[model samples]
Target chain A: MPAIIELRDVTKTYKLGDETLNAVDGISLSIQTGDFVAITGASGSGKTTLANIIGGLDRPTGGSVMVDGNDLSKLRDRKLSDYRNQHIGFVFQSFNLQGTQTALENVTLPLVFARVKSKARKQRATECLQAVGLGDRLKHKPSQLSGGQRQRVAIARALAVKPNIIIADEPTGNLDSQHGDEIIKLLRDLNKQGITLIIITHDMNIARQAGRIVQVRDGKVRA
Target chain B: MRLVDYISLALRNITRRKLRSALTIFAIVIGATSVTIMLTIVFSAKGFINDQFEQNGTFQQVQVSPQTDINWGNGSGQNCNSSDCVKLTQALINKLAKLPHVIGIARQTQPYNFDGLFYGSKKLKLNQVVAYDANGIIDNHMLAGRDITQSDGNGVLTITSDYADGLGFKNNYQALIGKTVKLHTQGYYSGVGSDPVGRQQYMQTHCQNMGPGQNCELPSVQITGKVVGIADANGLTNSSGYTVRVPLSWARGMEENQDYGPARTSGDYCRNMPGPCMPPNVLTVTDELALNGYSSLIVKVDNATNAAAVAQNIRGTFKIGAADAETAIKQQLSVFNIVGIILGGLGGIALIVAAVGVINTMVMSILERTREIGVMRAVGARRSAISRLFTFEASLLGMAGGILGVLIGYGLTLIGNPILNHQLKGNNIGSSNILSLPIWLVITVIAGTTVIGMLAGLYPARKAAKLDPVEALHYE
Candidate 1:
């Protein structure tokens, strides 16, 4: 099958005073739709930078980044926001739920940004929360929820947008091993449901669960 | 995003930070309250001044007199002398009286020389003794006792209550009737081309004009007349003294003796005699006759509808400056407007300070929610949308503060007027207090405050919007 995310000689550079650091250099890769891929690397190995480029969160310094046949490199800031809203859902290491909002409202944030009707947003958010096994914790705030539960709520928010891809950057970095395994299993179940999944991680066990694993050394993908 | 959604979001944010929001709103309230109170005081003072003017018959009445010597030295040479004062003569008064819309015609003559009065144990001085014809129009409402009539013009005189009070009368109206008063005239003469000391010697030489009197040369002429009426005391009336309603005939002959040439030629001659001395200078077909050469004309219009037409006709005829009540009101309102703007501007500084508080609070919120913004941006929220959300929050804060300020301001005025009135008891202050706030003023204040609030949020909102998703996500 054709790939849903493709990177062609993607290069990302960071200027630090008088020196330049290449975060991701000459990375060429593709992942098919419904594929569960993990980009694994140690600290400062460009794994998160590669994930950002694939998720359309950051533009590569030099090279083409195509997601679902759409060129992300050519999209402006506004169009990129629209593209992300429609095609990408993000999960973060810290389970970045809006602390002021309840779990249900956090899930509804993406739909609210989409200008969805209030009633429909509520209905969709509720269904997504239920899918993540957080149906009973809808009214709980992020501070009230456990670290693992907050990650679940974040997952539900990502799914509520119904995007084609879920891009998680160290999705279990803040949780214990048991909670991390549960989060990985939930992501795997979502991938089985035909949604493409991409994870950036440092843990070898987490990388083993992915259908395909790409290893990065320095700024380049390892052979 | 829709306005309703923005409002909801903003309201939610405000409710989340209740204490900070309340403090910001309280600042606006204080600013608005000061503006309101100051405006009320300005309005009340203007109303009070206008009321006093109206009581003095100045609202509809104008004073026409020659520019004084002081004005001439000030480079303002506008004066009504013998040549110009002739425009408002007896002929004009008679002509105006014949007009269909003409209400009343009264001629006034100002005293040229003031003569001091010496009676039993008390000495009274006269500054302005206006002699009006007994047949002329008089405001009966101002009469404390009986007004001067045609029969009393022979020798009787009407004094103001202030003058009567000065004469040691317990009841001005009752005690002053049939009482006789004396007049003492003082004359000073200095020969031309004399030195200062020589002028002083000449003055002393002219001081001996007294006949069979004490060595001090006090010329006393006891002209006794019954006090037919006592008039109301306008507060401006000096305790110096005043006598009204003597016959113009006696006053004209008296002007010759006093060498008051201007008073003799102005109206004292024709008003005293029942005959014509010279041809009329200016002719008017309306009862309301204004003097062209004088500073102003005091006209009493029987029909207010004819006022505009008469004023227009006079302006065309005289070719000088003319103003009515409406013009005067507009002038007063312009002054009030300037004062209001200055006060509003000072109050605006306080609102600006409150707006800075809003920006600070919003910036803190943005900093605290950096990761959340990253999450939102990752999920496809646009930068413009995020900026609009923040701006909406600020606008809501301003609008809320504006509403609360208005309520507090209006409430303060409602409660403060009575207390002010109580403090003014026994004074000449008017019975009613005027603190009027038009609806347009309220709307402008609220809208202005909201705009100021929104402006304060703009830079912070832009900063929050420009934050990079990657950088925000990486933030600890």
Candidate 2:
């Protein structure tokens, strides 16, 4: 199968006052379709920065980031948005579900921005929430649901757009061990269904569940 | 995304903060209402003034007086010979009448009193003594009685129904036509040796002064004439305050003989008695004679199509000055416009304050929805789209406010009319209380409010649009 995401010497730099720091320095990596890859590192290990670059939320300072055959490094702001919408989805550490919207509405938000018709967007959002084991919580707001349920809603939102890749940054950071395990299993099942997944984490045990593990320290990837 | 989706989203967001939204909408409503009501008042005032001008006569009418100085107290100050004054003259009248667009010409003389009707010791005041040669042009549709004619110039008196009623006569025109009445003449009885109080001391000093049987002066011969016609007075009154109409010839005779009252000029009376005080050519039109002087001359155009051209021609012919009705109306309208602008400006200030409130609320909303914004950006919303959503929300608030304002304004106008009518009734001034709102003004207000609302959204919308998705998502 073809590599759905390719990173070639992708260097992301951050300005720290007068000096520049390399968050993702000259990292070359690839993940094939249906692969579950884990990028594990301590704090300041550039794992989250790499995830941001791969997800098309941030541009690389140098070199290329190609996902689904489009170079994200060269994409303009508008094209980057389009790329993210069609090819990559994000699940944040805080389970960034809009508290004001119901679980179904939160999931449907992506499709709404994509200009999907109301009925189709609602139907697809409902299906995605159900698939995430949130079938009974579709009408409940994020504040009304548990942390695990909110995380599930966020995952459902990311999957609702039917993107090829899911990029999660510490997806289970705030959940209890049991809920965290459930979220990990959800990602593993999605990967088993042929969707590529990339997760950034500091937990060695969580990283061990992935098919491939890449360790990073001081902005460099180690085998 | 589609407009419907955007609107729905905006509406939902507004609904989420219902109190904030309602407050913003309320501000807009007050602003719009004040603007509409102020404009309506200005419009009504302008209409009322124009109506008054029209009722008086056309604005084109101008009265010219040769330079002289006299204080008639609310009267003309022109002094010229009667002939020179009359030189506004048949020739001038005919020339003006024959002008291409001139419609009609008529002349008027001051009021005169003929005879007194004494009904058992009470004397009622008469109304008018108007004399017009072309009575048809003078508007003779009286509430009662017929108009005087050329024959009535010979001592005939036309009494109004009120006058007849006052005199104990049957309040019918025909019944009072040939009825006899006593005549009384009052004037300064000054002669070569006549005393000032001869009339008052008549019984006491009559025998001593007249050497038995010869009266000092035959109590100024009181002449009685049959009421040949009971005519419509057209609101003109004789000196006694009775609504009266006499023939033009009779009026002229009264003018020449000093029969009306005191002679306006001692020189005029002296000039007629064989030794002229001044040159005959230097005839003086006294302030009293000029009391009936027209302040302006109204020249009506024959063809409405030719109104402008005729007005221009008259201006050129008179070489004095000219003002067309349209120009006059525009001048009147400009006052309203100025008043409207001032009021609109005041309303604009209010809207600005409301806009600031809108901006603050939107900014606060953006702060609250940081993560949501980031989520939208991640989902494919461009910065511009985010900005557009917020801006759209702001505009909707303004529109809601504007609509409510218009309603409130109309309601105010509805309530104001009765109050205005009641006040005017107390003063006996006739007026209509309906508020006049032109279609263009309504459209302007709506468009203006929308634009203001949109402008108010711009800054906040830009701030919302420029937010970085990654940073925003990290915001707590």
Candidate 1 lDDT over residue span B37-124, tens digit each: 5566567657754654455343443222232211101211222344633354454456545645546544555434456654466777
Candidate 1 stretches with Cα past 4 Å from truth are B36-297, B300-342, B419-433
Candidate 2 Cα errors over 4 Å, as ranges: B38-103, B106-297, B301-327, B420-434
Candidate 1: residue pairs that collide: A85-B380, B62-B298, B248-B272, B249-B272
In angstroms, give how far residue A202 of model 2 lies from its true place. 1.4
Error of 1 at A197 (Å): 0.6
Model 1 reaches an interface RMSD of 1.2
Q: Tell me the lDDT of model 1 at B239.
A: 15
Can you write out model 1's per-residue Cα lDDT over A1-223, one digit (the tens) per residue? 8888888999999999999999998999989999999999889999999988888899899999988778999999888998888888889898878888999999988887788888999999999999999999999999999899999999999998799999988999999999999999999999999999999998989999899899998889898
- Predicted complexes: DockQ each: 0.52, 0.55
CAPRI class of candidate 2: medium
**Best candidate, TM-score:** 2
Model 2 lDDT per residue over A100-172, tens place? 7789998988887788999999999999988998888888988899988899898998998898899989999
Least well predicted 10-residue stretch by lDDT in candidate 2 chain A: A80-89
